[model samples]
Target: MPISDVSSLLPLLVAIPLTGAIFSVLINSKHGQVLTGLLAALSLALVICAILLGLPSEGLQSTTAFRYPLAGWEAPLGIALSLDGFSALLLTLTTFLVTVLTFYSAYYFSASPARVRFWPLWWLLVAGINALFLSADVFNVYVTLEIIGLAAVALVALSGNKAGLTAALRYLLVGLLGSLCYLMAVALLYHLYGTLDFAQLAAKAESNPLSWAALALITVGLVLKTALVPLHFWLPHAHGSAPAPVSAILSALVVKASFYLLVRFWMEILAPAVTNDALMLLGILGGLAILWGGIQALRATRLKLMVAYSTVAQIGYLFLLFPLLMSAEGTSASQLAAQHQSALAAVCYFIVAHACAKAAMFIAAGNIIHSLGHDDIAKLQGMAKYMPLSLFTFAIAGGSLIGLPPSAGFIAKWLLLNVAIDTGQWWWVVIILTGGLLAALAIFRVLDLAFIKPEQASEQVAPDNWQKVPVAMPLSGLALALCTMALGFNADLIIDLITIGGGE
Candidate 1:
């Protein structure tokens, strides 16, 4: 495919899923699932095509950034969807995950009537995520963010239990508050610069009081949505009480959407207004989140909640990039630029690694809960005997979470450690190592119980009491987990794709 052909298909990434969402509402429940799955697969193909066609023929030079103006109108007056290497990488990640989860969800909600509602909302959430990645303007981002939050809330409520309903309500309220804050920032920027386009805002933005205010507002809003420490009170319950596939999507992709926006604002559009003090503050919160989330995970008695809290810890790793980038302030111009690129690349790797690892973990947890009728950690003794695949899936995914060697998580953390060391911020290195140790403890806590022999187990359940889980559930999870390991071996390809469009 030619670059132009691939660029023309960019809008379809959003359109196909959005159309599927609408059509799902008008179709039969079973057919809706089929349609949603097919559309998600198509979206994934589009993303793959974009990456292959947009890659330069030789070297590390970036391909041209493609922009598709809606209705022949460009930004400032009309919305434009963009397909640069950054957005392309995220789109590929988003579509790939959604495709796999769509299959997992088909079997997950197969017996439940909620499948009727799940398919539409699932596609809606996918549409929103893709749109947010491609959005060239702040206002469009806010619009897509709202779409994603609302769809996710609806999906969460589909669980139909009191706990699920309560968590969904809390999620809705928190999402609205975050959206309001982000909208305020959008309005402020538009008023000051008379434009909502990111490129325009970046060019026109000044290091002034209003810009700083907008920065603060954007940061708080995105941080709240991303479920960073201190403001992350709503994430655990919402992720834990939701259905397994919903839990997987929330941990793997939903939080990343908001974080992606925060990165764009902090590192690109608002770069001139960003201060070392602010970056350090973000790093401080990230470090605290790693410790606090890890402690919470260790304390969690339920398997799902442990994975949910672990998400909080994994999210903390991404924020460390901000402070590490700040540490390059005194370097030579070439060195500073190189450090910036490396830092961005590291965060990108972390995001993809976490998405795959965390999604696999949640699906594995879901499979265990599906088979055993509950996710109580203490009662999971001899899980290896009854549900070896699910337990193994969880352990393998957990290994990635713990940054074990030859896993994607190890590569991400290694890159981050190098950046910290190169920038002379050895303190972050300590935090990184400590967080990994804490993660290992939390992960192994489950493994030790699951792997115990039935005869030697402390809280063994009867073999006859276990229910049969669908074969697809554990297999899907294993596939995602293996993808994480595979990523560890192919960092160069991902890095090449990410560095496209000038590594922005």
Candidate 2:
């Protein structure tokens, strides 16, 4: 299949969500949720269509057939949209998460008027993500980034509490700053290459002061948005204070958007200009992020904040791929390609695992926090007696984060470790193992409070809303966790898909 075969349908991915979001605003409270669900389903269906029709067996080796020019104008003058293995995987992940989040939100916000407001913003955010993944132009990505940032900030403020408001303000500022840097880079790239298209720029990019400046600007902007360490100061507050579903989206998908862009830039557009020393610098930052973030998570007093900080740690693991990938270039020509593909597959798998695991953990945390009326771990005594489902959900999610057996995280970690050893990048091995152990400790610290036998089995009375916790709520978390665990067995499917698009 070529992109032209499905070019007519590509716009629908962006249109469906944008329309749904606007329609949500006009609909009454009673129908808002329904509109959101329908739109999410339709958007997800569109992603499936993209995977099937836009991705030809030829892969990215010759992309002329798959770059769909928008509004009858070709690149350098008009927008273009392209899909490959990488974009397909991310689009699928985004829609799947949105679908689950939509359904879970219906039950989560059933009692509040907030559901009405949540629907529109949620749909807009989905629109942004879908657009970002499909976009073939860097300028388009910048536009999508603003859409995502604004929508996310609005969602965070939906709680309407002072803390949520404050967090949203900080998030807005940080996002704007990142956008400015990125916009500057885009301008410079356009000026230097006379094009905004990824493929075109890749061919034209040079190892010069201009390219380096652009790379530096783009990297800083993306890392800030990605919440990479030193720049991750705002994440805990924003994630912890936002509503649970919002938190899940922010942690699992929002940050990944920036990271995805970074990957595209580093691996494709800017690859010729990047040096090994620069790549090594990124890997070292990742190692530090793992250690520092894990320690912060362990020290956090609230469960939600702990989960937020854990995101910081897991994000670090994603960066470890850089060194392994860089080192692969040194192998013999016969083996070099295989090593590259393996490293790519490993990192992609890790990202998928983290998304599923982190989303499950946050959803489960939301439930526990709601049930206990607070998120303080020490106050979770005897949660096992009444909230066993949530406890189990949390445990499964946490286990995945810790790279436990039969989980996606375990498989990803295994692949990464093997690659590190094979590539002779043994330093990352220590960081990987240490990060996993620290994750285990952090999760256990929270679980330990849950399992503590209080003076009485029923010492903590169920909150008003917990008298009969809906099967849907806890099941939502369980569903995501199950997906993560199932990935351990189904990795081959993902690898094949990514390999096609990656053309490795």
Candidate 3:
């Protein structure tokens, strides 16, 4: 297969899903279910095509990236789509999660009127994520992030309950504030560099007052969007109250989108303007996020909230890479180069691992919620008796979160530890280990609830047949967990793929 043919699929990635979303909304009243299902399948097919085309053939060491400017116009004037190794992997992850959540959504909302609204918004979010990952310009990135935020807020509000609506409103406000900050940065960058194109800006970027202001603005905005601590006030309410499948994708993929853009901008366009003091500050915040999020999770009384807070903690691990990556500077020429690659590779693996594990955990939590008709941990005693598969899935996903052996999280953390150790940043090592222990405590709290046998029959609420654990539900969670664990065994594949276009 020609690389060009594969590269051509880049535009279709954004187009197909957006088209599916629109078509589903139009045909929903008459044949919404069938039409939406078919469209989702079609979108998934396009996603697979893009990924397969993006991958290099055997014996090939590098894959060519495809860039297509809209309307045959070049950047700084026209919009463009571009995909390389990093974006391709994220696109693949986004599509896979959407496909799985689509299946899970069908089962989850089978009887709810909300299904009509869910499919379209879900695909819209997918489209936004795809577009953001492939976007080559900062302005286009802002546009895509808006789409993602709006779609996600709509999904959260789908529950139509007071809690869900309130949470959605909070999320929308936070998202808008984040976007505003990011837009300010984009404006500043464009004004300074005369172009918003990432490559163009990267080449023209410098350490100057205007650039530093943009950096601060972008950092604050992205950190808020990514839900890094102190700014993460809205995540638990939003993720906890949304539907299971909604929560799954929100925690697993939505939050990661902002962080992804942050990484891209920092590494590609703003590295020259970034300072060591700033990087150190980010690492400190990450360490604090790990501790704070973990403590909150351990204290959370609801399963979904616990999982949501776990996302906060898990995200901290990704931020730890910034300091480690910064440490590469001022080193020997060869060692500096190697350190940069390792840091990128480590962060990428950590992202992939967390995506799978967190998605699995949320799906499983959804199952447990469905079976018991509640999400309270205290009321979940003896749930393992009825929802064994979900409990098992939770255990596996939690094991990954705890960085246990033979899990993707383990491999990611190992890579991060080596990077920190090699750079003599051993303080982060203690933070990492402590975060793991806290994660373990948080996870086992739910497991402890699962192990308890209800003393009275009245204590357990018997689920209706329709509310019983669907075979597809647990399978969805299990499949993600298995994939995460499988990554541990095939770490080299992840390392190679993440490093594809991440070169000097």
lDDT of each candidate versus the true structure: 0.87, 0.85, 0.85
TM-score of 2: 0.95
Candidate 1 residues 313-364, lDDT tens each?
9999999989987844357867776888899899999999999999999998
Could you tell me how far off, in angstroms, the CA of residue 209 lies in candidate 3 after the best superposition? 0.5
Local distance difference test, candidate 3: 0.85
RMSD of each: 1.8, 2.0, 2.1
Lowest summed lDDT over 10 consecutive residues: which window, candidate 2?
Answer: 456-465
The runs of at least 3 residues in candidate 3 whose Cα sits more than 4 Å from the true structure, single-residue gaps closed, are 29-31, 57-64, 328-330, 452-458, 461-466
Worst 10 residues of 3 by lDDT: 57-66
Candidate 2 achieves a global lDDT of: 0.85
Tell me how far the alpha carbon of residue 182 in candidate 2 is from the true structure, in angstroms, after superposition.
Answer: 0.5
Could you tell me the lDDT of residue 445 within candidate 2? 86
What digit string (tens of lDDT, one per residue) describes model 3 on residues 1-504? 566666666788888888888887887663576457656766666766656655664323432356777777888788877777777778778877777777777788877898888888988998899889989889999999999999999999998999999999999999999999999999998788899988888889999999999999999999999999889999999999999999989988999999998888777789898877888888899999999999999999999999999999988998997898775546886787698788888888999999999999999988977766778888777777778888899999899999999999999999999999998899999999999999999999888878656443246545442267679889989999999999999998767766666555
TM-score for each model: 0.97, 0.95, 0.95
lDDT of 3 at 448: 81
